[model samples]
Target: MFMRKNQIKCVSKAVLVIIILLFSNELLAQNQRVNSKSNNYFWDNVQFGGGIGLGFGSGYTDISLTPSAIYNFNEYVSLGLGAQYSYVSQKNYYNSHLYGGSLIALFNPIREIQLSAELEELRVNINPNDPSLTSEQFWNTGLFLGAGYRTANVTIGVRYNILQDDNKNVYSDAFMPFVRVYF
Candidate 1:
């Protein structure tokens, strides 16, 4: 148990160091670009994005959608909210659904880098194999923190879920990667 804790600490420290180094580089670039970019109207600072996916197979099908919008309060900070929905069905026995919302705060030191934290609340329903059983709703909360790099309008990042439960949740891991496209 002690060893696991130490490993976690090490991993956390490594991630922090990487973020710091990248952020500092971005700050330097930002300082150089500050004079070239114009500060537009508030409406111009709004961004919209989302992701959707679908999968189908002989025994299963899955679908998910997430939509979000963010308003940049300044060059350094932004706020956003989004909704998530997902459905999974197995040919005969398994069925599940998830729906939720999330709020995030982001700090951008430059155009290509952002540090963010999010809080999400979701309700999930899983049906048992037995047809007689009723579907039960399980409420879950996920708090995630991470950093992302942007290329044009797309951002890619790795996130760690702080409240994931292997036995009671649909997510497979505490760590996951994300991609977002903005308009």
Candidate 2:
């Protein structure tokens, strides 16, 4: 009877271990599916796009065409580079090449709508012939708030510049409407 009881206890323990392991594996699989679903909903890869825009503020008016590209490391974070050519009435109407990277964070409360905050640096060079200045190089830092809508592979957005400093003169706040294509 003593040997039989010992054998029964060992079998029971083995069965209990097997059940525990099975349950644990099932839980792990469920967690993996949930994780994958969440990752799929979030944008965690590189994105590229470009658009044209116009800026009018204070005593300055500009028509610009810009081409830009970005690498989004995750759903909430991205870095980008862009160049712009602008014709300004207040200045000598020279074209400026701008290269800057922006760090942006996105908040999406719904499937189609997203809000973002970005900090960027814009480098500008003034026309040498402008009587108001001899030679000027502008390094402007701008803070922007934007909202976007996504449809298929395209995103349409509007942004407001809350801060801008051109080193020589500061201009009034401005707004930009843009579109981006994702691949």
Candidate 3:
């Protein structure tokens, strides 16, 4: 069944997260010894931040929440994970829920320039009020490549989803602009 598939995916993702955390714990132990002058160097290089949004218009509404964290491997590279959840509704149309997780990698070629690649997978559920339309549920995937301008803890840029196609996706368009910040 479709629900069974989604459950499997969720379990797989959770296992991956646990494995990554264990590996990171080992790295953290090693990094602390590498920099004696800065006792909290490893923790200092970790940043936490996320995004929240709400949109409402005539007969329509949307809400989203995403929480994420990243660890700077060095000045030039960082890797992170993010979780997303959203709800959308359009009166007389449909109501939908989407939840997902992502892995992101970022590179800084210069102090002001950043490039990134992100892989995301989401489960979408839709319910229609109209009896004629059937409810639907499925999984969607997106791979985005982007570039941006950075200042301090913020980055503003545009990203293109390489996996976007005719199939239903989280993004309606292949290109989207974004703003990211961490502290």
Candidate 4:
């Protein structure tokens, strides 16, 4: 009788351990399945959009138009390209027609917001007879860093020019505001 009682107690303990292990495994599997489903939904619905804006600064003012498109490769990474045109005027010295293409890489630290960096090569044509010098075609390169916020289909942000160069060193230290539309 004593041996039988000991045997039954041992069997009950073993059964309880097996039941807990099975329950935990099922919970873990369900959690993984839910995460996978969310990932799939996000990736299937990537987006693309662009915008145009006007800005003014201390010695310069510009009217600019930009068109851009983006491909969201994943939740954290996106690739973009844009075309921009601007008419820029600077304090009776130079008036320029600027056009450029930009390549951008974006990292999203959170949903609906992104940190972006871009490289652009712009072709600038100085107006002739502006009392500065002869008209010339020049190339300018710009590096920009900025943060952006998006709500629905509209995006708004400001970017600081980290570096700027012209064929002639006439202008530097520019900042601009940009707006984007995603369709």
92-141: candidate 1 lDDT, tens digit per residue? 78788999999988888888997889999999998867788887788988
lDDT per model vs. reference: 0.88, 0.67, 0.93, 0.77
Off by over 4 Å in 2: 1-44, 52-95, 130-133, 165-173
- State, as a TM-score between 0 and 1, how close model 4 is to the true structure: 0.59
Tell me the tens digit of each residue's lDDT in model 2 across 49-94. Answer: 6666677876567676666666665555556665555566555444
Q: lDDT score, residue 72, model 2?
A: 62
- Residue 63's C-alpha lDDT in candidate 4? 82
Top candidate, metric lDDT: 3
Residue-level lDDT of model 3, residues 23-118, one tens digit each, is 999999887777774757778898998899899999999999989999999999999999999999999999999999999999999999999999
* Structure candidate 2, residue pairs in collision: none
Where does candidate 4 stray beyond 4 Å?
1-48, 54-62, 89-94, 165-172
TM-score per model over all chains: 0.72, 0.52, 0.78, 0.59
The clash count for each model shown is 0, 0, 0, 1
Error of 3 at 7 (Å): 74
